[model samples]
Target: MSQRSYRTAIVGTGAIATAHARAVRAATDRADLVAAVDIDVDRARAFAETWGVPRSFASLSELLLEEKVDVVHICTPPQQHAGLAIECLAAGVTAVVEKPPTLSLAELDELVAAESRSTAHMATIFQHRFGSGAVRLRRMAAEGELGRPLLATCDTQWYRDEAYFAVPWRGKWENEGGGPTMGHGIHQFDLLLSVLGPWEEVTAVAARRARPTETEDVSMALVTFESGVVASVVNSVVSPRETSVLRFDYENATVELEHLYGYTDKNWTVTPAPGHDGLVDRWAADTVSVPSGHDAQLAAVYDALDAGEAPPVTLAETRRTMEFVAALYASAFTGERVRCGQIGADSPFAKRMDGTGTPWGKVTAQ
Candidate 1:
C-alpha cells in the first residue's frame, strides 16, 4: 500500500485483456503493467509484448511466484473468473474481474467468501456506471435537480449472429452465463441500478426465439425499484439496429443516453420540464466529458487502492446487481414475480441462472 504506483498484471490474453492493459498503461502514475498470464503461454507473451509488460507466464500461480503484483486484471471467461480472482485475492492482490463475474450466484458467493478472508478485494467491471453522462445523471438525481425519478427504460439491443456463438463459450448456459441478458445487457441494467438504487422486484420473460444457443437470446423485464420507480428492461442480441439506450423520466426533466457499447457526455440528452428550464445550463456544465471505458474506472480503482480502500463496484454492489440477474431469470422461468432478497441459498436460481431447469424446455444448441 505504500508503493507510489501499483504493479498490475493481466491474467488473460483474450481481446478484452488488451483493453485492460491499455487502461493500466494510460494511468502510468497510479499503476504499471508488469505481467501477463494465460494458459496459452504464447498468447500471453504476445500480449505482454504488445503492452510493454515485463513478464509473461502460463498460469497465475507462476505469475505470482515470478512477480510481486499489487493488482490483477481478470479478463478471462466467466467460468474462470472466480478461480483466478480467488487465487489473486488470497495473495492480497486486488482483482478487477470482467463481467458476468461468475457463472452462478453460488460462484460469486465463493468470491465474496474469499475476499472476506483476504487483505485484497475483488471488483466487477461495470464501466458504464463510470461514464460522465451516468455520473452527471446520478448527481443530478441525488441533488434533486432532476426531480423524483418516475419511470425508466433500459435496453441493450444488438446483433450477434449464429457464427458469433461458434466459440465454445459464447452462447452456452454454463460458459457465457445465459446469453445477452447475462453477458451483454448486464452492463446497461447495472447502469440503471446505479442510477435508480435498489431494485425491489422483477417480472420477466425470456425466449430463445431466434438464436441457436442453449440459453435465452432475448429477455424483457419489468423492474420495480425500491423508490417506486418502474423500469422496462430489455436485453436482446437479435436486433439488427444495434443500440444501448436508457431513459429516465423525472418530475423535472427527462434524461436519456444512447450508444452502442460505451458512451460519453455527448451521448446524453437532457430536457427540463415546464418551468424547470434552469437545468439545461446546469446539465451542460455538469458533464465533464469522461467516456465510459476501462480507463476511467481503473483510475478510480487505483485512487481507492492507493488510499487503502476498497475499489469501485464493490462486491456488495456487485451482489445487488448480480442478484437482480438471478431474480430476472427466476421470474422468467418460474412464471412468477421475483422480489429482492428472494433467491436464497436454498433456491435453485442461487445455484444457476437456468436453475429452473430450462424455461422453454429442451433447448439444444443448433
Candidate 2:
C-alpha cells in the first residue's frame, strides 16, 4: 500500500454523515477528515467541530475550490447522489456514496460514464459485504466448501412510522426512490447477491400497506439466480418486530445471519447437514471478527486506493444490485416477471422506479 495519506471530505451532515466521519477518523493513519459539507451551513460547522475536521462548506463547489481532497463521502439523500458523485468524478476525486447510489439506472449510467473518463472512480457503501462472516461465507461458497447453494432468504423487515416519513424527502418517488426495497433492504440483499452471484429473473409484489408514503411500504420477490439458487426477498417498513435476516441453505449446511442493522461474527450461525458436521471446525477456525459498518468498508476502500485497484463494491457491482432493485419494482408494478438486463434505456422502470406511475393510486398524504 502507498504510504500517502488520503485527504477526505464528507457531504451532508445528516445522521449517516456522523458514521462516515467516525469511519474516516478510525482510518487515521491512512486518511484525514479534512472537511465537512452540508446545505445547512450551521449543521456543517457543527459537524466539523464535532468531528475535529479542519473546514466546513455549504456546497461541494465551495469545498472543492477551497481544499484539495482526494476522496469524498457522499451521505446525501438518494436523489442528489448522482449529481454530487458526478461532480466528484469530474474533479478527479474518488466518491464513496451511500446506498441507493442513484435515483435510477439512467442516472447511474451517467455516473459510470463520468468515472470512465476520469482517473477517479465511485464506490457505493454496501457495508454488509465487508463483514468477516459475510467474507468467509462468500469464500466458502466460491470454494465449493459450502456445497451447492439451494435456497436462500433475505428479509429486511423494519418499522418506520409517519414521523420518519415526515422528513421532506422520505417517501417520494422522485427523492428517496422506492421506500424499503431501495433504501432499507438493499443492504441485506446486496450481501445476498455477493454470495449467490448473478440473478436470472425476478417476480415481485408491492403494497403501501401501513405507511403513509408515495412508495410501497412493503415488497416481496422470488429471485432465481444463475447458480440455480432460488431466493425469497422481503423488504418492508411495516413490521413491528424489526429484523435484518439472511439465511442460505446449501447442500452441506445452512448459514444464517440475524441482526437488526450491523452484525459481527456472533450474529452468524451455521448448521451443518448430517454428513457435513466436520465443516463446523473449519468455520470455527476462520474466526476474524469485523462488523458490518462504514468503518470496516472505509478501511478496505483506502487500502484499495493505495494499491491502485478498484475499491470494494465497485460501480459495476453496485449497478447490478441497483438493476435488481429496478427489476423488482418493474415486476411488482407490471405484474410480470422481469429478467436480468430486461430493464434497459427504453424501460419505464429505468427512467423512474414508480414505472408508468403507481398502479395502486398515487399517495397524496405525506
Candidate 3:
C-alpha cells in the first residue's frame, strides 16, 4: 500500500509558526503546508506567502471550514492550546501542539478526553526527544550497555531580559503558564523524563530573583525516579552564560550533552568508566547523527499519521511531563515534597500552576 500524504495547516503566524512551516516543507514527501491561520490577517497572509502556503485564514474555524487539513499545528499562546486542540480533534484532525501543551493538568485532561472521543490524536512538540543522540542513549540504556542510571542533571539556564518579558504573555503565570520552567526548560526536562521513565517524588524551590514577572525567574528541583535514579533540575532565565546541558552517570559510563537550544550527535559525549574502557569503542562505532529540532520531530509525526498510529510525544507522555511541572510548582510553593499522582483533580496545582499562589510575597517594583 502507498503511504498517505498529510495536508497540514499551521494556526498562528508567530516566530515558531515559521519553524513549523519550514519543517513541513522539509518533509515534502509525506506532508504539505496547505494553509496558515492567525488573528492578524496581514500576518497570516505574509506567513502564507513566505512559506508557500496556498491559503491564509484569520481563524482556525475558517481554515477548518475551507481547507482539507489532516493535521493542525497549534502554535498560538499556551492559553489557547487546549481549546484549539479540542476543536481540531472534534473535527477528526490531528493536533500537533508546542511545548507546555496546556496551562494546567485540568486543561490537558480536557484535550485527552477530546482525543478519546475522536478518531484523531494530539501530540506535543518535545523535539529534543527525537534527536539521534537521544535515540542512541535510550537504545544503549535499554541494552544494558550504559548500565543502571544513578545520577542525572538537567540545566536550562537561558537568559531573557526585561524587554523580553515586557510582552504581555511572556512571564505571567496566567498567560504563558510559568516562566523559564514552563517556557524554556520544559524541552530539556521532558527529554530527561523520556530517558529516565516514571518519577517518584520532587522537592523544589522557585524564586523571582531578577525578572519583573509574575512567575519565578529561577527554580531548582530534586527529582527521584521510580528506577531509583535521582536528578537535579535547574531552570533559570537570569544567567548571563546560557546553556542547556544534561548529564547522566551510569554504572559503567558517564554520558553528557552540552548545547544550547538544540543538539546534534557531536554535542554528545560518552566516557566509559576506568574498568569499562572497552565500551568506548562500542559507542564510537555506533555512528548515527541527527540534529534535535522541529524537522526531526515533524518527520516522525507525519510518518505516524501515514501509518495510522499515535504520533511522537503522545498526549499521555506530555501529560506526565506536564504533571512533573505541576509537581515542581506544588513543591516549590507549598514548601513540601510532592509525589507523583499527588496533584489529582482536586489539587489546586492541577487547576493552575499558581494554585497555592506565589511563594514569594510580592513582585517589588523594578
Candidate 4:
C-alpha cells in the first residue's frame, strides 16, 4: 500500500456499517476510520465517538467537504447507493458500496459510467466471493476437475416480519428494488453467477406469501448459463427459519455447499464420477477456510491497495450482477424468457420503480 494511511469515512451508521468498520480495522494496517456520516446527527456522533473517528457529518456532502477522506465505505440502503456513490465519484473519492448497489439497472449503469469518468476506483461488496470455500469451488470448476456441469441450484429462505418492513423504504420498489430477490437472494445469486459464469436467459415467478410488503416474499427463477448448464434459484422471506444452500451437478461429480452462513462452507460433499474417485478424494483432502463475509472482502480490498491494483470486485462485475437482477424482474413480470443482454437500455424494468401502495400480491404484472 501507499506509505500514507488511507483516510476512510463510513457514510452510514447502521448495524452493517459497524460490521464494515470492524472489518476495515482488522483488514487494513493503513486504513483509518476518520469519519462517520448519517442523516441523524445524533447517531452519527455516537458512532464516531464509539468507533474513535475524528469527525462525523450530518450529511454526506458535509463529510466529503470536511473529512479529507481518501476512501468511503457506503453502507446506506439500496435506494441511496446510486446517488451517493455517484456523488462520491464526482468528488474524486474511491468508494466501496454495499450490495445490490442500486435499485435498478439504469442506476447501476449511471454509477458505472461515473466511475469510468473519474480517477477514483469503485467496487461493490459481493463479499461472498471472498470465502475460501467459494474460491475452491470456482477453482475446481474452472480446472475441469468437476468435469462437465449439468445443473445448479440455490435456495435462500429467511424470516422477516412486519416490524422489519416498518423501516420507511423496506418494502417500496423504488427503495429496496424488490423484497427477497434483491435483498436476500442477491447474495447467493451473485455467488452462483460467480461460480457458474454468465447467465444466458431467465424466466421467473414471484409472490407475496406472507410479508406485509410491496414486494415478493417468495420468488423462483429458472436460469440458463452460457455454457448451457441450467440452474434453479429460490428466494424467500417467509421461511420459519433461515437457511441457504447451493448444489452443483457435474458430469464427473456432484458438489455441494450447505451451511447457515451460506458463504462459509463448513459442510461440503463431492461425489466422484465413477473412475474420478481419485480427483474427489484429493479435493476432499484439501481444506477450505476463509474469514466471514465482511472481513474477507475487506482484507481483499486491503491486499489490492497494497499491490497497487483494483479491488477484487469491480463496477463492471457489479453491473453484470445488476443486469441479472433486471432480467429476473423482466421474466417475473412478463411471464416470458428474457435473455441477459436483452436487459439493456430499452428494458422496461430499467429505472422503473413503481412504488404503488398495494402489497406484492395485489399488484398486477405490468
Give me candidate 2's TM-score against the actual structure. Answer: 0.98
What's the TM-score of every candidate structure?
0.97, 0.98, 0.98, 0.93
lDDT of each residue in 186-304, candidate 2, tens digit only: 99999999999999999999999887788999999999999899999999999999999999999999999999999999999999999999888899899588899999999889888
Model 3 segments beyond 4 Å from truth? Answer: 361-366
Alpha carbon RMSD to native, model 4: 2.5
Which structure is stronger by lDDT: 1 or 2? 2
Candidate 3 residue pairs that clash: none
In candidate 4, what are the lDDT values of residues 80-180, reduced to their tens digit?
A: 98899999999988889997788887888898799889878788888888888778888988998888889999998888888999999897787888878
**Candidate ordering by lDDT (highest first):** 2, 3, 1, 4
* Residues 151-241 of candidate 3: C-alpha lDDT, one tens digit per residue: 9999999999999988888888888889889999999999999999999999999999998888999999999999999999999999999
Model 1: what TM-score? 0.97
Give the TM-score ranking, best first: 2, 3, 1, 4
